[model samples]
Target: MNRILIDSSVHHMRIAVVENGKLVELHWESKAHQSIVGNIYAGRVENVVKGMQAAFVDIGQEKNAYLYYGQERATTDSNPKEGRKLKMGDTVLVQVTKDAVGEKGAVVTEELSFPGRFLVLLPEDTREIGISKKITDTEERNRIKEVLKDSLPEGYSAIVRTNGAKKSKEEYQKELDVLLKNCQAIQQFGQYAKPPALLLQEKSPALRIARELYASEVDEIVVNDRSIYEELLQAGEFPQEDGVTLLHYQDNTPIFEAYFVESQAEKALEQRVWLKSGGFLMIQQTEACVVIDVNTGKFTGKKSVEKTILKTNLEAASEIAAQLRLRNLSGIIIVDFIDMVSKEHRHLVQEALEQAVRKDRNKTVVVGMTELGLMQITRKKTRPSLEQQMSVSCRYCNGTGRYPSIDWTVSKMRREIESIFSNTIYQKVIVTANPKVLDAFCGKEEVFLKELQHKFEKTIVCIPMQAMAFDKYHIEKQKDS
Candidate 1:
């Protein structure tokens, strides 16, 4: 059974999609750092660089939004046919396509779209009726296309969402009306509103997910908050005839814990994931890309070594795809599967990987295996991954996960003390450093410190400061203690 569990009783709202008792997708939204990806704003052109064919629009965000007006990149609303050039002091309606990530500002598009439960309304377009690629049934696709053929306004276009399949024309029309009303309201308000004003806000993350799951195989939608449960029902987000049950969780146990989502989500943050077959996967996220390595640990098939490797690789392919969606890891990815000599075996593994990722909401492309036995894949990134959102860089290791070795620190300290003695007339010196480093510097019987003192003809005292960093040391000089 497919179930969407929403836990909104905490500061950060979390949604987990479980299919067949296995967590497949996880999402969270925080009140403090709310996302503005689908927001519509009346923005003022702050700067226009003709050379770059882009403009910087002030949308009342922390950073000015980037708008591309190039011929190829211009949307229908940008009016490329008339050759409209945005200039400073000009106001226009724009929708946020991508949120601000890192130092980059939110990416805005003049082509505005309002997404509904069954359709996404596009304003000022060529009346194109597009359907989702996921709705692959030819007869159903044609039926939906016919239903929405003449329903839209003359200047409006829309894309039939995946869940629109098998829905009644009235249902489609009802959603269309709501979306059209929303679009019209935004346009009418933006005309007289001041620049940098917000015209519309997207639905909250939990409600938004529920609205999108009408046509899915989901049978149950559970919410821990009574208010949210009432809101979902009052909005008529799910069809009553679809046999989808709306349940308000009243269990004293936390919603996530009750569904086993808390433990599953915690595993997504780990670097090593153990497979059921005793094999393990090493997943590492780096600045450039995410790298995953497959290892056959303690898994020896009864048949042969080749069979063991192939089995492990096939299993890993599926887990890797699940991890990508669960962790929301995006951008370039390189996978190093176990070596297989047969060309046919490699093809099977690649096919398995491609099939597994098809269920992901984000667009993921597999670029095939390389000559060096590494598979390259690319996933679209609109926001930070789960790791980036949940954790910060380690201060002790500086995020490198490595510290200066004791031998290295001890050697460096000796050289620094020698240099200090040669440069100054101090007869005594006191060195303070991390305890672990002090142990190395003092040696087994304080022999190292004694040797250094004899060489410098100075009384040296070593103080271990637990608070000091391993890579750091401080020296104080005294004139004949």
Candidate 2:
């Protein structure tokens, strides 16, 4: 059964999707992060960089937002700021196209989109009309297009969402009207409102995902929080679907923990993943790209060496796709598969990776293999990855996962002592560092410490502090030894 479980009682809201009794997707949103993508705002252009063809807009936030000139301009005539350079004080209607990731601000666009249950209203332009690519039936697509012509606002266009395929004209009209009214409200508010004001707030994360991803084929939606449960009921259209049920889970245990999702989520954060065939994937995420190395851990095929290598690469390719989606790893990716001599084997692995990636909702491109036999895949990135959102950089290693060694620390300490003696006059220099660094520096017989004192021609005291942090130390001045 395809089921969705939403837990909102905690500081962050979590949504878990289980398909055929296996956890396939998990999304987390913190309540404090009010700036979600797709929200409409009345922004003022703060600055324009002509070289980059981009503008920084103020959207009533701490950091100024950014937007490209051709953010969503499909055609030249569709450009709202047509043939005119946006100045520092020009007002424009914008929407959050991408969430703020890392030190970057949210990305906004002049193109406005108001999404409803079965349609996304693109106001001020009625030139474009289409149906979802998922609705492949030609007849149904024509029917949807005809219905859109009638129900859509005069100066607006829309894409009939997949859920609208089987709906009657009246149903489509109702949703279209709601979206039109919302768009109108946003326009009215943007006219007189102050710059950088929010015109329309996006729906809650749970409802937004439900409407976009789970509108069809979802058997049940179970929410743990009572308020969110009631809010879903207030919408009053989801539960009306055939055989679809809305459940309020009031059990003592959290919804995610009870459904074995917590365990799966924990595994997703791991760097190494073991496949069923006993081969493993070592996944490392860097700033520029994600790298996955395939290793034949314990899997040995019954056939020749070529067969074993092919089997391992095929298995690794499939798992790489799953982990990318499950962990929400976006941007450029590089996969180093076990080298195969045959060209046919390489093609089979690439095809398997592409097939596995088809199930992902995000946009991905397989750029084929590089000269070094590494497969390159690029995925769209809006917000930070799941690991980045949930985890913080380490204090000592700064997220590199490797701290400086004792010998390096000792070297750094001596540099500090030398610099201190050259700059400041003191009778004795007291070096206070962590026990590990002190042990490595002074040694058991204080050989290094005595040599340092003799060289400096000043009393030097080594103080081992168990409570001190490894990466930090204090070189303080002392009048007496």
Candidate 3:
């Protein structure tokens, strides 16, 4: 049984998932006044590239929004147009599909779907009947599909969620009618509302999760906020007495700490994750993909070499799965597992990895291992990972783990002095820097600095400061007497 608890505050929103009374997953999202999700806009199609079948739309933002032709619904009002059909001044209704990232604008789509408790209403595609793949029962799927087929309107579609499984036909029918009514209301509102307006706002994250993920498998839903708990109870979706407990935490101690979730969350942020077998995995992420390297740290197996390698790889498989869920890592992932000798051992290790990842909620596919001992895997990415959300690049290392060399700093200082001499009328200049930086300026680079002083006809003095940072420096110009 798994329990979920949400802590929503003004600055940060945190969610903890406990399985078998132990914390398994913890997620936090910071609301720093820069949210770009679920924003609807009236965009002007700026440019339509015929070859790419895409257009760049200006949505009154710094960067242009992207719209793809395939994302647009097949409508009856569309003319079979060719050669740049969309013009510059054309106004279109667009919904943001992807948020604006580094150097890229928001990805918008013409076809929009509003998500309800147990259904996603697609206003454009009516005949399309879909169900969540997570529900494996064929009879339940067919039952839900039949209910959706009867209630759906022309030129609209409703995707039944996983929660619809095992629900009675009467219950499903009732929910479908309620959802269809809401969709109709939204459509009517959209017709009367002004352009660049939001017709339907998505539910809050907590409510959204409950609608999407809450099922018989969930043991309890604990929330720190009383108002949100009351709202969930009022919705009447989650039953109180059927082992689905909704707890309102009022303790002075933080709810996350009570569950030991904060410690697990801190471990997820680290680059090196240690395994119980004394082996470790170092993970580094870039814009392209995440790279994981396996290492045999303190593990000195007294067994044969082949056995040692197999044990390390086996340990890595489980840790890799846990790290993926803990960090919310997604997209292309390359794992460099410790090389094993036996083919059977390799196959067993891969199978172990597949079994370990079965617990994750997100869909993951292991594409098999390569000859170079690298295992390739892909996880569905919905948003930015935990690291990108919580951390920034180091100022000193600039994320490369290398700083400016002493010689480079000395040369840069000389250039600054020369620039000041050519521009200003200072008589003496005092340069203060760390011991290493000052030593480079006075030791091997002393001749260069002296030549610059002679050319400028200005007195220059080097002052070494031990307390200064590696990158810290100061230049002071002495007034003429």
Candidate 4:
């Protein structure tokens, strides 16, 4: 059974999508760090970079937002000023399409959209009606298209979400009315709002996920926080006939710990994943793309060599898809599966991967295998990955994941001490270094310390700071006793 577990009693609101007993997707939001995607903003153009065909707009954020006008023709809407050229200090209503990652600013666009429970309202879109590609049944698609065609206001368009296929016409019209009202309010507010003002904020991450992901497969929606649970109830988010049970968790134990999601979440952050077959996968996220290496560890199959390698690759194909969603690893992905000489075997592995990724909410495309036996895939990235959201770079290694060698650290410390002594006139010096570094610097029986004092013609005292970083130290002149 699939479950949507929400732990919102804590400062950080966490929501996990569990398939059977395994965690497939995890999402979290805090007040200090909130997603701005789908938010409408009245922004002021700060600079127009003609060379890049893009303009930087101040949207009341630390980093100015990036707006590319090169695709204006493609995004032409019903507004009279839709494709107008932007200049410095121009006020334009825009919506954030992508959140800020690292040093980059949020990517905003003139084409704004408002997402509802069953449809996404596009106020300016000329297209009358659109349906989700997931609703492959031609009869159902036509049914929804016809219902929306008559109910929708002229010039406005909407895309029916995946869950909309199961809803009745009355439900569609109800949601459409709400979305249209919101669109009108945003437009009215944006007209009078000053530059760099917020026109409309999107729904909270928890509600957004519940609204979009509570499809036919999800059986139960469990939330620990009473307030969010009540809000969901009041909003009529779940249908009574859908057989979806909404439960308010009243257990004393934390929701995540009770559900065994805490341990699984920690495992998701790990670099290596062990499969049920005893084979392993090493997933590494780099600046450009994610690289997954499949290894046949302890699982030496009873069959022939070809069969053993093929079995591991097939298992890896499924796990890679699950891991990509669990970790929210997006953008370019290259999977190095165990190579098989047979063309048919390779075909099997690729088909398995494609089938697994079909369940993903994000658009993931398996771009086929390369000449080097590497399988290439791409997932649309709009926000930071799980790793980037949950952790920061190591301070000691400066994100390199490697520290300076002990010998190298000692040598560098000696040079720094020499330079300090040469530049200052203090006779007595005190040095504080990491405990391990101090042991190496002091040498056997304090021989290195004595030699340093003798060479510099000054008194030296070496103090060991256990809390200090591996390669970090402090030096200061000692006061007269």
Which ranges of candidate 3 are over 4 A from the true structure? 34-41, 58-63, 71-85, 185-195, 399-481
* Model 2, TM vs. native: 0.80
- For candidate 1, write residues 1-481 as lDDT tens digits: 8999987732356778899889887776654577898899999999998866789999999999999876564465554432368889999899998877657899998989998877899996589999989899999988887888867788899998877778888888888888888889999999999999999987777787677655568899999888889889887767567778999997645676677676787676788999999999998888899999999988888898888999999999999999999888899999999999999999999999999999888899989999999999999986677776555555676776544444444555665666567666778889999998898788778877777677667788888899987778988988886
TM-score of 3: 0.74
Task: Give candidate 4's whole-model lDDT.
Answer: 0.82
Worst window of 10 by summed lDDT in candidate 3: 401-410
Scored by CA lDDT, what does every candidate get? Answer: 0.82, 0.78, 0.73, 0.82
Residues forming the 10-long window of minimal summed lDDT in candidate 4:
73-82
Prediction 3 global C-alpha lDDT: 0.73
Candidate 4 residue runs with Cα over 4 Å from true position: 72-84, 402-481
- lDDT for model 1, on a 0 to 1 scale? 0.82
- Show model 2 residue runs off by greater than 4 Å: 71-84, 402-481
Q: How high is the lDDT of residue 462 in model 1? A: 84
Model 1 off-target regions past 4 Å? 49-52, 71-84, 213-215, 399-481
Error of 1 at 474 (Å): 33
How would you encode candidate 2's per-residue C-alpha lDDT over 59-138 as one tens digit per residue?
A: 98878899887433344544344434788998988899788876788898887888877788887664578687778899
